[model samples]
Target: MITFCKYALCFAMSIKKNNIRLLQNQSYSWLFAISLLVFSSLSYGQDTSVSQENDANKPVIKDDFEWQIILDLSLIYGPTIIAGIEQEKLSEYLMPGLLVDISYKGFYLQSNQRRSHVLLGGTELGYQLFIEENWQLDLILKAYMQGYDSESLIEYGGGDAELLAGLKEREVTIGAAIRYSQYFEDALFRIDFAYGSSGEDENENHVGGLIIDSFYSYLLPYKNWDIYLGAGLSYFSQDIINYYIGVSPDEVLATRPEYDAEAGFRAQAEIYAQYPVSESWSFHTGITHSYFSNNVKESPLVDTNQTTQVTLGVMYVF
Candidate 1:
């Protein structure tokens, strides 16, 4: 008994040491990101000053924020596939609900499409922290859903004794994100870091995680249409993967064993097009595909390793 106790204590100490090291590394990464932003902003400021002096005779375009305050109005409808679910007949296909976007100057808010039956999609609000001709930065807030409410999953054995005896409502994750965008003549590159927090998972359990995403996009303009292609890689923390997808010991049954998901990566690609129908009306459509990593794919709750999303809609600029 004494030897066992000593071994347990040593294991506990090792875990604590590892946690501290992880925290230090995260802090260093954040510091480095902030430093880069500050340096870029200073350099851009000086360049802007020089350009103003060179173009003194050119008429400055006054921002019409006071006159045209509201930014965008749109309506979108589309059929999308929700992948990686047990009940394909009920949860695989869906018609997206209302979509809206509003913005002013550097601040914006938008709703995104749901990719899974377990999720309620999310709302993203962002404010530009810094902007220049080729570089821009934003601070963002996103409200994300982690799992399906028991009521919604009733068809998939929500209250059944064997499969979902203790299922509950989806956990909401509110994330604070930082985004950096770089613009080229016909391409754009973006990187994002987000820290997510969750209050309770119906069991009153607190959860938190982090994500990092990097993407590159290219545009092709032909006639009245502009087409875009984009690709990206995403990283999710272990805490997030576990809370949303992993199975717990108590919740495991004969068929579903306990699972502990680790930090993982995902790859994504998208193609979209926009065509102007008139001065105020425009049509837009896109399709996106995401491939999950083995850590996520190994979950018993998952049925597919990849998911696809498609949307078609129209927008009105006011």
Candidate 2:
């Protein structure tokens, strides 16, 4: 009887260890897969030249020597978890930002401060690589931060009460993207492929990821109102999913077990309206809803599978 009990215990232990190993290997495989996808997508149109043989006579907007500057102020509210903590509700913030653009010939230097990944606001620096009538490619560097403060497990009275603090810090990534845009009578379609990786996060965690985005929008003009309706779809790579949502062995506690996050997808819809109040000022309001995938929603850190964001702001052009 004693021998049988011991054997049973050993078998259970072996099974648990095997499961953890399997998850680790799968995460690594996903990382490799996204890397391959990024490389292939960047090389897709490298050798071919887009022909303008018959369209050369078409008029092009050559604002080559122009410098565009804009200042914006807004109130934004949303919750996004970089790693699970219950205090993400406090992360909502106000944004006062600036945008500057200068172009010479077809090349441009641009900088914009705005909300980026997970609703975290930051600055983006980019250089236009190839620009034409309908397509453009850029090399970009972006700064990202989850928030200044992280959530503590004690804030939520659960089995995770003993878990450590979950504060995340800022990191930066460098990447490239190719974007194509087409306009019809009153609607426009845009699609882009972007991939980036950061060396180490504030928590010393490795982070890298890829995203593909497609958007369709329509503009309707009524009196002094410009209404915009837009829908977007984005694919998030497994590496990124794991970094933000997965729980590793070191992070696992009694209540949080190891989780392996697969690639996920997001669908979003938004409606925005802009009304000119003066020659230099405009008032805008927009609301957006984003739905997360199962892979991300299944994470122990995630409390909700969907997020809704609303913004009311004013912009001034200089």
Q: Residue 232 lDDT in model 2?
A: 77
For candidate 1, write residues 1-318 as lDDT tens digits.
000011111112324445434534554453454344434433332211110011111221222232221122221221211222232321122122334455677676644321111022345677888767677788888754333433334333222334444644435567788988777767777677988776554356777888786777677666545666778787878887677667777667786778787887878787776655444444456676767776676776555566665554444445
Identify the leading candidate in terms of TM-score.
Answer: 2
Prediction 1 global C-alpha lDDT: 0.50
CA-lDDT, candidates in order: 0.50, 0.49
Pairs that collide, model 2: 150-167
lDDT by residue for model 2 over 267-314, one digit each (tens)?
Answer: 778777665544555555677677777667678766666776676655
Cα error, residue 301 of model 1, in Å, equals 0.6
The estimated TM-scores of all candidates read: 0.63, 0.64
TM-score of 2: 0.64
Residue 267 in candidate 2, Cα distance off native in Å: 0.8
Give me the candidate number with maximum lDDT: 1
Task: Kindly report which residue stretches of model 1 are placed more than 4 angstroms away from their true locations once superposed.
Answer: 1-106, 110-123, 144-146, 156-165, 199-203, 316-318
